[model samples]
Target: MKNYIVASWILFIIGISLLTSCEKDPWKFDTDRKPGLYFVELADTNEISFDQLNDSTWTRKLFICYLIGVPVDYERQIEFAPIDSASNMKFGEEYKFSDAILKAGEVYCNVYLWAKRPAVEDEDGKRYCTFRIVENEHFVPYMYSTAFFQVRVNHPREPKWWDAEIFGAWSEKAFQVYMRYYNKQEVENTDNWQKYYSTVYGKNMYIMNDATWEGVPALFLPLLKEDVLVPVFDYFVANPSDGVDIPEWYYEWKKN
Candidate 1:
């Protein structure tokens, strides 16, 4: 009879433990907490040439969501509206997101903005577009953000005289050294060629004006400083096929 009573007590304790275990802490959405997605803005603005648009698609992480310690398992739709009414790009025509649904277990997703190349020209032959992410049922737009992203797509600028012959093919180490030597600013032309005048120390600089050298596409200079002579830029232009070893001039610049 005592054993029976002890067994009953054990069973009762087991039952009480089961009831306590079954009870769970309540979970409520923190209404006071401001949690939502935001534009990562990894790059405030992105620009790509038409050649880069070969695939007719470009991607930008226009939005990132905060992990609110809960999974947003529901299918949510995001709204993309243009701030510029007069912009040339048309929604559902020029560009679109490959997928609009924010899938489950995803903290962030990328908006793949795509557009077709049109055979047309407006003075510059470039198309400009701007977009902003809007709020939806699942999340709200992040505060303290411009909430806007800009895209500029255009054709690649024409190759300059020097670029046509030896832009990347040649080692421009000496030219780079010269820039550092003078502490000069590199001015870019419409053709995107780095152009600037020689420094006072480099007054005898050899300029490459014409396109051809030795009957080949060469770096030619219109102005050659006959009196002053810094043969660094000239030597590389003359010997495009040779490697650019560190010259004594570069060492001199370092000493100062």
Candidate 2:
């Protein structure tokens, strides 16, 4: 009988705690809160991804929700400002946002974002921007914050197991061609190559020390053939970069 009373009390306490936690849970989307404004969007919700060669612009729909017991009698304009310093993609050139309007009797409104590709691909071709509300007459900025957008590039990186012997000494162009032939992309030796090659861009690249590459060569033997290098050499012959013109080693391979 005593155990039953004790068990009942324990259950009662557990139920009270759960009710309290639910009341305080920030993610609990309750409409009965004190009047406030908040964004119903995630940090990466506004991203624009594109292939530089194929795509130019992307349009996205976004939203803002708030708590109000009564319907707003008139339309209210919600304004936003670019977090300028955080924005990498330029305003007039790469992106544009139109002010959104909250119509009468509506709890939410739509926001539109348009993104344009950069004129020339920057090294990684990735850019970012953030936006936040500028308070207006109807309502002010809320607890939940800002909108973020990214123009992120998705280019393949050279595999960790990339050995210069297979690609015939790595050049930016040569690696680009090699990626087409090689199917595997393991993260095993990425750091080893960086240390072994000690590559400095357009400078003292590839300090060929046999000892540095001695132990791991057999384990990470890159797939290669003499003919596969033909396209690599051909790409450079057709289109050479201004600064790091084709290396002599590629030509040497062509002659032999």
Candidate 3:
């Protein structure tokens, strides 16, 4: 009887442990949780362009935009919408923007890839395009198409900020700092190309580097300052290919 009791106790303990372990393993969605900025890949459809349309009537639909890290308040956020109209296509027909509530802090923007109309000349001599939003059964909120895209936020505006010291110094001192940081022998050796590539293009690279060398000033300048390290790191981490061999003058000047 004692032996049976002991065995029963062991079984009970094992069951409890299993239950506890199962509880700890919560279900999770496959998403990244970086603190800022993200990109979402969109499906390609010919309907998003103006050339494919039979008539002047074309429309673009805004689909979904993806979130990268944690959510933030949208109240203070500013959205910049740029349409690709290089093909002599009208812009209005190619894109429309809309929003939907997913969960608290998690919202979605739908982008209709290729619904466009032809251009109409207005009385002021300016060309215009027409677009419409339709509700479809597959598309939630009926009569609208939705998809996700990559997005960036909290990005920097100044590329020079990464090399702020160089930007601020008198010409000689500034040049000296630039040479010290960018033209080191360690940087120029082509064998380290892999390191540079890994830094710029590797997955999650954006989170790794915070120096000014990482950013594209043209894109980041208006958003952030030169002294902020986070944006610089993000830029270099995402673009290691931008790394170059340190110039010969950098080494010579440093030796001097």
Pick the lDDT winner.
2
Whichever of 1 and 3 has more lDDT, that candidate is 1
TM-score per prediction, in order, is 0.38, 0.41, 0.23
1-256 per-residue lDDT for model 1 (tens digits) = 9999999999999999888766632464665553466555533354423342232444343344343334566656655566565356676676555575566767666556665554445324356556666666566666432333344444432223333222233334433433343332233221112332442112212333333334322122222111111344455456553555433443453356
Residue range 109-134, candidate 3, lDDT tens digits: 44444433333332121232232223
Can you tell me which runs of candidate 3 are displaced by over 4 Å? 25-42, 51-61, 66-107, 112-256
Task: Give the 10-residue window scoring lowest on summed lDDT in candidate 1.
Answer: 220-229
How close to the true structure is residue 10 of candidate 3, measured as C-alpha lDDT? 100
Model 2 CA lDDT for position 71? 59
Rank the candidate models, highest lDDT first: 2, 1, 3
C-alpha lDDT of all candidate models, in order: 0.45, 0.56, 0.35
Task: Show the lowest summed lDDT stretch of 10 residues, model 3.
Answer: 147-156
By descending TM-score, how would the candidates be arranged? 2, 1, 3
